[model samples]
Target chain A: MEKTVIDAHNISKIYNPETIPVYAVNNVHLHLLEGEFTALVGPSGSGKTTLLNLIGGLDKPNEGNIYINGTDITKLSAGKLIDFRLHNIGFVFQSFNLIPVLTAKENAEFIMLLQGIKKSEREKRLQQLFKEIGLEDKTDIRPSQLSGGQQQRVAVARALASRPHFILADEPTANLDSVSASNLLDLMEKLNREENMTFLFSTHDQRVIERARRVITLVDGRIASDSAAVPTSIPHEQVVT
Target chain B: MILLMAWRNIWRNKARSIVIMLSVAIGLFAGIGVLALYKGMMKSRIRAVIDSEAGHLQIHHPDFKKDNHPAFILPDANALLKKVQSFPAVKMAVPRTLAQGMLVTTTGSAGVQINGVVPALEYSASQLKRKIIAGEGFHEGKKNEIVIGKKLADKMKLKLGAKLVLTFTDTADNLVSSAFRVAGIYQSGNAPFDELNVYVSLTTLNEWLLTGNSFHQIAVILKNDDDLQVMQDQLKKTYPSLLVQSWKDLSPETELMVKTVDEYSYIIMIIILVALAFGILNTMLMSILERTKEIGMMVALGTAKAKVFLLVLMETVFLTIAGTPIGFLAAYIVIGYYQKHGLDLSGMGKDMMASFGFETTIYPSFPSEKLVMILAMVICTALLSCLLPALKALRLQPVEALRR
Candidate 1:
């Protein structure tokens, strides 16, 4: 049985449709299935992040319906959309935006707390996640005390802490050095393999694109190419879409 | 966790937060200090009225207070005085023979309230002997001795032993005159009272009026202030025909002054809190502006708008709570110290204060009950102050804010 986590149809986001209109994301259709390690790759102004924002429910599209796990997120109210995102979607930003004042563990537990998870359950999950992310010792350290790669790892842990249906990461490794970026990709790939977690990243890094089982290219808010149809690198665990 | 985050967030800009906290502390300190001072001054005035001028309770003939007419004297004032004196709470009870008269000297004449009092009992009621600045009080077994205020003595250009003639209508309505020599000059700090009042021997005044054993009023002083209203109610029940009144009833102006001071204290506190509120608003707004990206991240991470508002509100509360204890402790120490030692304003001019019937030295009294209201007002102010900044945080779009 295949579960389609995201099914966005004819989504078009215009910055200023009334005056001096700019189509940030124009007339695009995208679908992501459960347990798919996919990459959304494009040059600057090619609308990779914009499309990601639309699918992540961070921004509303001017036209078209976005269904996340059978719920039309585009029709949901602002407050409902936020709750939907909280339960079903995890976001990883380019800057690894962990709350500066909170320790890495606190940041990771933030989403679960918002979900009203009991302390015992949150602690159990946090212990497993921190150990899996290789940050068990760094859990008490604030983001400022951690390196770029460590902070990104913390962000990843925070995203997974809520057990969202899927993770949407935008340029997750842009700020990291080559070694840190490679290490982060390796950790993300490991999570994708072992935990069967779905990851959809918008990035310019070829390293990220190479590891992605299926790559989707966006050109000016339209899907230019999708490797989902053609079988790519991973012969085993084929994309179910 | 939101509370912890809010608490830690205030310390991000330590200097700014400290500045706002210090503003709150200093504002409350000054406000509490001024309130205590005003309370002290008013309390002193009220005590003076009750203890020195109008004893805690007074009983008079129904018509006596209407015009101080000598003919309208209390029918059995001595009996009433004895009864009042027997009460356990009664410290002293004295009979007064009041007459409206004119005092004439060679150089000038003035209208005066001639209070004919038994020196021994009057001294116990008013402590008037301590106020005498010149000569001794009425001599024992004195025939025709008078105690006039220093203001009256100065206005008439008269010294000790100077003769003055007092003329008033006697009981039969015939005008009668008597000559008296001034024995002592006293200054009671109240200029108006000093200028208008004179004291004389009760026996001598009765003889002059040809009204034997009759007095206009009986003044009662109590041992404890807490017994005032109860004693007054009891006395009122005992003397149904006569007019029995408490000091508040006798001196409505002092009572009004006390109420006015209370209203003014609240107004002063509100103004100070409002000023401190503005400081809090500005600081929290700046903090929100600086953390736009961070706040947007939290919002995007499914932190509800209500939670965001709470976080900002809690930050302001933390700042205010941090400052409040310092303010209260400082005020307590200063007010407690001065409550015993007194804060002297004599350097500002004793005459000015005395003219207004205020003591040169004031003892500050901080009512413990007021702290609860002050803290409630401070918390309300903090909430009001944080509203704008919190709304601003709520209005943020995660996509746009993260762009910043």
Candidate 2:
């Protein structure tokens, strides 16, 4: 049985008081299972990101409990929680968020480099991840030099380098064209199934939700639906693990 | 890796980087140059004082320095002179008979101190040799031949071979008089000495004082003038009864002038550092603002807060290291240029410098101490200015940073 990696209960994020207390996240409860591909689908201002941030320990909840890998991250200090995030969660953003000064491969290897891994071991892991992402030729190119698909691959590779149990990608495909977005979704889906690594994405794109093993729809800061998709003989569409 | 990244990040905007560095570099150059100039001025001033007045050390009767009176003459200055010559730094020691006197010539009358020296031995002990500017030097064993300073001779309307009557009281408290023929006119360019001091042979002074073979003070010249402090301290312990005074003690005003100029160097350097530190703060703060998301992501990726702070600090350190040397080189070129062709303070500026008793002609000199001090301050400021911005980076939340 795959252990549940993330569990949240009664979490609410309140931004301002005068504006009807915008409930970015309101009493939303959810679970992410090991190796599961869960997509939180919502319209703009629906709190998809707030819940993901709470789940990723990138934020704190005003009231409630969050458990990741059976540890209550809500109780951890800010510094300890940052370490926990580094060790457990990997993040991919819409902008790729690669350090501009670093080359493409260096950006991909950044997390493992932070984990104090030896250079040789980091290089070995980087080689495999780059080959898996199919950017073996663009290793030395900087983020500015790469196409959107290539940069996202590097970001995905960077996200996976720490060997975290799951990945949190916030609107990761928002910036890409349809073709590049489809290519990235295919890569992410492959990695998800091949490595049995759980993936949580807060995205509005129907294309993303359609490929998910489980799709969660959030409306007005509440989870409206959490359902598994019917399995089909869809050989390959996305690579994410 | 973070440091390496931070360093490379500096050149991402080369013009901006150079501008920030130029601010620090210019500050450093000004700070160091000002310090060197002040210290050099003080050094030259003190050297001029010692060279013209006391050489290095002067030995007087214990009561002579404590209370100024002719009665307190060194019992037998000849005996003390013999012992002082044995010390290492002492190049020569000669007895001098000093007395408050009045000089009268056909043209005018002036109050002065008649300083009597041993013609040959005093050559190594006083500024008499360098001050001689006109006519003929006193011939050896020429009795009654006097070398009067140019100003004193001008006041007395006396020329070489002109005779004058000088009156004074001897060590025994008895009135005495001497008539001497002026042998030469001298100008040491020091107002106090050139205007008031008159030089005469030791034989003439002994004959006038009726003391036969006694003197008041032993002027001791040392090989290295800086060793005066060490020699004075040692001599204090060696001969507690004898009073030895360095040039620093001879004229408190000149000593204070040298000290004040030296202190100005530190003050001006600190002010330069303060101004430069703010420029660095602006640059570092801007840099942190530009890389906010990057730093936040690095922290999210498990870079420790301490590492982030260190990374920023290390980058600044590298920048200062590279830029400060350029500043040093620039300062060195200016100093070297002035060192060769000293800055001219002639015309109008010369008169202004006279307020501090400095010559109208200004020279630039480089001291290693001032260079080291400026470099140290630049590095310290560069590092310190990184503190606030690094803390801001530490506070950046990973997710919000990306959203921004």
Candidate 3:
């Protein structure tokens, strides 16, 4: 039994609570062990993003608690929760939100810089991540100068720079073409296998679901199914070519 | 890294940033330039009054200022003048016999103030000779020679060498009339002063008044104007019976002008700063609004709310810092040029300025102290302008901001 990295217990988030209430995330209980590549998949407006936000401590749940590495993050203050997220969790947005003014290397090193990592160590890790993402020559290029695929690669590198306990990616490949999407998934899979890095993604793309080892389906603000798949047995017909 | 990002972010919207900077620079220049002009005018007026009408300090018989009667005269005037001249700070002291009288010529008669001055001593103390516009100044052997203002001469329809009659009361309270010839006509650039004052030799006026050697007033000029208050204090302490006054005390209107000009400059500065603050606020707010998502992303990545506030503040400060010095430099150059050549308002306000004893041309001057004050004011304006936008940045929630 691997150590549990995330333990969420009956968390609920209600939007517009008083007038015409909507349950964005309703009483969801979930947990993930270390080194697992999990995917939260559902149709549009099914609360996948809301559940991910709760688990990452970006938003507070109205009821119940979320624990990351046995720490009850739901009880932390806004400031402390931010600090906790900085050291314990990484996030990748769907829009590839890289700071436009910074170069790729600066973007990748930004998280470590915030964490007070030493200058030499930040530079070394940034170089290794850029090389691993096949963006060694693009270190000095700003986000505007890079292609969409290259920008997403830089975003991924930034997420991995701090070596967090788990990474949460929200529709990470939504904006990418098939070729770029396939390359990104392959890179993430390689990182997961070699480094035993844990990742949780909220995605509707079948390509992402196929690569994920564990799939949790959400429907109408509740978890509808939870199952594990054999990595080699994914149907190629369902993957977007 | 935050500072670098702020700097780069300003250039992201190059046109907008430049517009804001130009507005600030132009506003500051206009405010400072107008203040310099007003200050220059006040300074010129004060200098004219001090050098021509009132010396650095003056002493008079305590009763003489209440009434112009000849009996109210300073006793031992010559000895007092000698003693005052001996002081190191006192450059020169000239005794004058003053009388309120009437001047009569062939065409008309007009009221005037008679100033009896010794030519040789008055030349060193008052520079009256340099101001003579028509006819030669007083000659060494000349008697009953008078120097009348051009306005007075024009009013009386009198010319140089023309005989004029002065009528006044003697020390015995009897009316006496004396005849004198106008030796020179002087124009002091002050219409009111030029229209009412006439000068003659003290020897002639003393004989006519039958007052012997007594004088009504003693005007003292100092080597350095900074020694005015000290010398006035010493003079008052020495001659407790007499009244000693500095130029500012004698001319309250000019002093008021000096004080009010400073106050008005600050008011104008505040108004201009308020206008600049609005421009800065608008630009900063727009910049923050456009980068809402980016700011959210930074906060989500663990940048503190305080750091986000600082980032916006730094952007405003950078914008102000870049433009303020340029405004100051431009104002300095303009004021410097006018200080050399003067800004000619003669064509516009010749009569108005002349009545107030100010020259037609004003030389603009800006002191180093005022520059420091203006810079401080600009910094304060920049900080004030950043508050609203910085607060807006601080209020952003990472979850909602990212969604936007």
The model with the greater TM-score, 1 or 3, is: 1
TM-score (C-alpha) between model 3 and the true structure: 0.91
Cα deviation of B208, candidate 3, in Å: 3.1
Chain B TM-score, one value per candidate, order as shown: 0.95, 0.88, 0.93
List the candidate numbers ranked by DockQ, top first.
1, 2, 3
**Interface quality of candidate 1 as DockQ:** 0.77
Cand. 2 TM to true fold: 0.92
lDDT of 3 by residue, B37-134 (tens): 98898878777777778888889988888877888888788889899999999888989998889998877899999999988877666678888999
Docking quality class, candidate 3: medium
Superior by lDDT: candidate 2 or candidate 3: 3
User: On residues B175-237, what C-alpha lDDT tens digit does candidate 1 reach at each position?
Assistant: 988999999988877777788889999999999887798788888899998999999999888
Question: What DockQ values do the models have?
Answer: 0.77, 0.60, 0.58
User: How does model 1 fare in lDDT?
Assistant: 0.89
* Residue B176's lDDT in candidate 3: 88
Interface RMSD of 1: 0.6
